[model samples]
Target: MDTLSFNHTALTAPNRTVEVGGRRLAYRRFGHGPNLVLCVRFRGTMDSWDPLFLDLLARDFTVNVFDYSGLGLSTGKPSYVKTDMAQDVDDLVTALGLGKVAIAGWSIGGIAAQVFAALHPEKVSHVLAIGTMPPGLMVKPSAPLFLQTAFKPENGIEDQYILFFEPDSARSRAAGDASVARIASRSMVVDAITPPAVMIQSVIESADPTTPFPDPDGRYQAFYRSTDIPVLALSGDHDIMFPVENWYAMNDLWPTLFVVTWPDSGHGPQHQYPELSADLIASFVKNNPRPV
Candidate 1:
């Protein structure tokens, strides 16, 4: 296929579907080169990602964005459990016949990415997490304002800035506006809004203090401490939902992990610095090619 024939962009990419594990999943595949499956955050569809970020990533990778089961255009029972969400990634990769693809996730989606990496190591080449917390107890819990604003029936531009970027920082707020505009350019449909009941379930799961992701026996923590899979997590210093400081607390554990934090920023660093983030991703993958 001629690359020029298709735009391979967030707005222009065609929606595709595939049957897996008795249900159909909705997805879009754009860009070129190795496969990169991205998981969306809570209350988010594949459509919510920043356009500039996707376009920049398309330069070196064939980005695959998908809705979890029963979300967006998909058809099946819905779940917000992080491990179950990771299972969606596994099943989709198997159905697509992709080999050793990089798994990227944002916010709660990043939790699923970490789960996928730890449990299904052979299926993943690397893990890219944006605006998310690492597994286990947080060094600092999420701000109450995050839950208050994030679950609103509708989030205005200001809410977006607070939830995803730094409203206090003029530059971050401007970047938020640009990203919101880019996202708004896409055609909107009613099906994209996750149901309220499901959102509630997600909220509950997100707050569960004893999530088995850490596992009582210490296996998952050990994986982070000693896995060969290269991991990269990006965040803004004051992320209301998942603070960057949590990653800092784990400094001694992850030998192969790299955390990038932007000053005076918030949750959505990729949206704020799309081009630089993409460059970092490409460089990370190039420098740490997964064992073939």
Candidate 2:
């Protein structure tokens, strides 16, 4: 395989499409190394990813980012169920002919990634989850009022700042500003945005898991605890949407899960501290080689 220079400009990266489960799945493949799939955040399109972060990850591994079945340029009906979404990811992986890939999931994508790992353990070598809540856990209503308002779709940039940056720190605010600018640099048009209906449905699906919210049956908890795949859970200490406490809950349930929390950061630590986040991810992968 030939190595290509990491493109700082995400829009310039060539967009490719593949047929998966009778739907057209759009994706961008860049960087070089063992295959690593990136599952994007809630309502995030293929272009919404931060180029700097992607570039950093691409430096060490071949990164694959794509649109969900009905989101962005992809074609099909969008299902909000995490298990179904996980199947979609598996279909795409098989469609692309990738063998034994690693995966990093952000926010809701993290939930889907967990499901994927549980369902198809043989196909996944490692898992990286960021700004995510544990499966079947009901989210506590502890977000600050400002952060709550920020969750609205119309809030836009201000919402991003509230959700992803530490409001009390100037440095954190600046990092948030730069990350947003990098996302805009992708030159995404309105058509590229995920539909409001789809976003709402996805959010609902995330909160209401198949096993039940709060995992009253304990089945969801058992599923994750049973998985022996190497897992790394990353978070921002100041995260508002999915607070740092969420990571603690996950750790409490699965004592073996590795956890990393960045100081003075919020929901999107990978964007706020791209270099550190990327280095941690690379090191984790390096340290935990797949069993032969």
Best by TM-score: 1
Candidate 2 pairs with clashing backbones: none
lDDT of 1 by residue, 129-158 (tens): 889988777888889899899878778999
TM-score of each: 0.93, 0.88
lDDT of 2 at 292: 68
Every model's Cα RMSD, please?
Answer: 2.3, 3.0
Compared with the true structure, the alpha-carbon lDDT of candidate 1 equals 0.84
Q: Per-residue CA lDDT of candidate 2, range 211-256, in tens?
A: 3224466666787786667789898887776776766767766844
Candidate number achieving the greatest lDDT relative to the actual structure: 1
Kindly give the number of clashing pairs for every candidate: 0, 0
In candidate 1, how many Å is residue 30 off? 0.7
